[model samples]
Every structure is written in C-alpha cells, then in structure tokens.
Target: MSDEEYKKVFSKNLLHFLEINGKNQADLCKYIGVSSATVSDWCNGKKMPRMDKIQSICNWLHIEKSDLLESQSADSASYYLNEDARDMAQFLFENPEYKVLFDASRKVKPEDIQFVKEMIDRMSNQNG
Candidate 1:
C-alpha cells in the first residue's frame, strides 16, 4: 500500500484499539505525555504521530509499534502460510462449527472424507 493508505489504515486501527482498550482522547494524551490536541489530531487522522510518539503510543496501548503501523513484519503467520494453507486456515478460523465437523469426521463417518475433500476443492476453485 502507499504511505498515505498505510497511514489511514494505521490511524483507524489505532483509534479502534484505543477505544477497545477503554481509552478516551484525554486518557491517551496523559498516557503518551502529549497534548490533548495532539491526541485529538491523531484520533481524527489529521496528523500522524512522530516516530517517538508512535513508539510511546504502542507502549501505552500494549501493542508493538509494527502492529500499530500494520507493517508486514507484524503478520508473520500470513507470511508463513502458503496459498492453500492460508485459504484453509482462514476458512476454518472463521467457522467454529467446522471444528466440530472436522473432529466428528475423523472419528466416524466416511462422509467426513468427502466433506474435507469438498472444502479443499471449493478453496482451490475460489482461488483460481
């Protein structure tokens, strides 16, 4: 992504993380030792934090700086997963019901073999 795109994504992610962490702008300002206005600018995406402030913000939010920035290094799992494994992992991770389906398939039904085969086929087709 372009730098501007990355910045926008980072800003949105930061705002979401802060909100989830129960931090308001005033709390973030105090935690990062920045002016309330500066925190406001960041929350609104009016300005990007400086490197030092970014580090401080990451520390305050209990996230790594790379994760806040959405840097490639922050997503090691994605990097390691091959195309097929990535697709399978994404599908299974999103559907908790599939875990039961998979476990039950292994213990008793020959139909479970067909179900897994169908899942792999569907993923391959979607990717193609």
Candidate 2:
C-alpha cells in the first residue's frame, strides 16, 4: 500500500482492536513507551509506526501483524458460502436488537435452520 493508504488501514485496525480489547491511547502509550501524542498520531492516521513498534503493539494486543496491517475484505464474500450470509452476519453484529436470532440458533437443529429462514422470508413478505 501507499504511505497514506497504509496509515488509514493501520489506524483503522489499531482503533478497532483497541476498542475490542478495552484499551485507549494512554494504555498503548504506557505499554509501548511512547508519548500520548505519538499514539494519537498512530490512532488518527497521521503517522505510521516502525516495524519494531508494530511488533510491540501486536504483542501487547495479542494479535498477528496482519490483523494490524491488512484490511480484511469487508466488501468480499470469500470466507462465507455466499454474499447474503456475510451481509446477514454483519447486520446481526451491527444491530444488537436481533441478537435473539443468534441466541436461539445455537440450540436449533441444522435441519431447522432453513425452516427459520423460510419463516423470516414469509414474515418479511407479509410485511412488505
């Protein structure tokens, strides 16, 4: 990636993991022995850290370097069986109101999964 693109990707990933792990810029600064301003620059996409510092942050966050460096394809359907499954998963994560679908699905039979989908489709059709 170009330098600007690298900054944006790294900063986005850094902020994502920091929030996931309940960490803030101050916590990162103390751990990496950098000033708060330096951490802020990294978090805000103003600058990129050196390789050693990237390794340090990875160790601190218990994540692989690729997790910090690479942008996972949010627009692609490579991992899932299809695009709809991926879109549904993203929707479920972004909207906690539908969390019961997830909670209930865990105990549901594999054969019943399609039934639930059909039920949803029927309900949506009725509403539409």
Candidate 3:
C-alpha cells in the first residue's frame, strides 16, 4: 500500500466498529455490496477504499467520515462506547420525543442546564 493508503488502512477503526457490532468481512461485504476480495483488501491493508465507496460505507454504518480517518496512534482506539453509554444512547434512539425535549433544552439557561447535568452525574455515579 502507498503511505496514504497505509494511513487509511491501518487505523483499524472500521474493523473495530465491525467487531463490536458483531460483523465480519463477509458481513461487511453483504452490507456494502462489495466482493469478498474488496473486503479482504480493506481488512489486510492492501488497499484503501475509493471516496465514493467511503460515503456508502459511512452511510451504511451510520458514521461520519472522520471515524474512518483516525491516526495510526489510535489503531487500538475504541470505536464503541461503554455499555452504560450504549444503554443511554439506545434510550435516546428509541424515544424521539424525549430526544426532542432534550434538544429543545439547549435554549435553557446555562446554570439551569449545569444543575440538571450535575443531578444526572450524581445519580449515575451513585448507581455506577
């Protein structure tokens, strides 16, 4: 691989995300409608994906382009949040109305927002 492609391939965030989400090369091929050789090339760092396919992959993964571009220093970086955070994310995902309310609260006073954040933090720390 060229140095630039090397950077893209070895970051390993895609592999990390795939594993955490219980997928493999075959699964990824199915999801992205690519061949096994293409997926293998990606997994083995033999090639970098084209920019066109990058968007397709990101859209399929529900991720932004930046997630695929972590540096080599982050080869072992985590892609998924912890279980508690995942639970909270799923809660927000399943409750659009609640998410709307939360989003709307952005207009609330900063001090009021801080107080609510602190309350959640204290409760979470106690339970955690």
Say which candidate scores most in TM-score. 2
In what order do the candidates fall by lDDT, top score first?
2, 1, 3
The C-alpha stretches of model 1 lying farther than 4 A from their native spots are: 71-128
lDDT of 1 at 54: 88
For residues 14-116, what per-residue lDDT tens digits would candidate 1 score against the true structure? 8776764557888887787889888877777677888998888877666677767774445454421245544544465577545433332112334444468
Question: How far is 68's C-alpha from truth in model 3 (Å)?
Answer: 0.8
Per-residue CA lDDT of candidate 3, range 1-128, in tens? 46766645543867865654556889889888899998887877767788887778777666667777654354453333344444444554575533432432212444443455567668768999
Residue clash pairs of candidate 2 = none
In lDDT terms, which candidate is top? 2
Residue 38 accuracy (lDDT) in model 3: 86
Of candidate 1, the 10-residue stretch with the lowest lDDT total is 100-109
Any idea how many clashes model 2 has? 0
Q: Order the numbered candidates by TM-score, best leading.
A: 2, 3, 1
Candidate 3 to truth, TM: 0.52
Q: For model 1, what is the alpha-carbon lDDT of residue 88? A: 49
**Model 1 scores what on Cα lDDT?**
0.64
Deviation in angstroms for 58 in model 3?
1.1
Residue 84 CA error for candidate 2 (Å)? Answer: 20
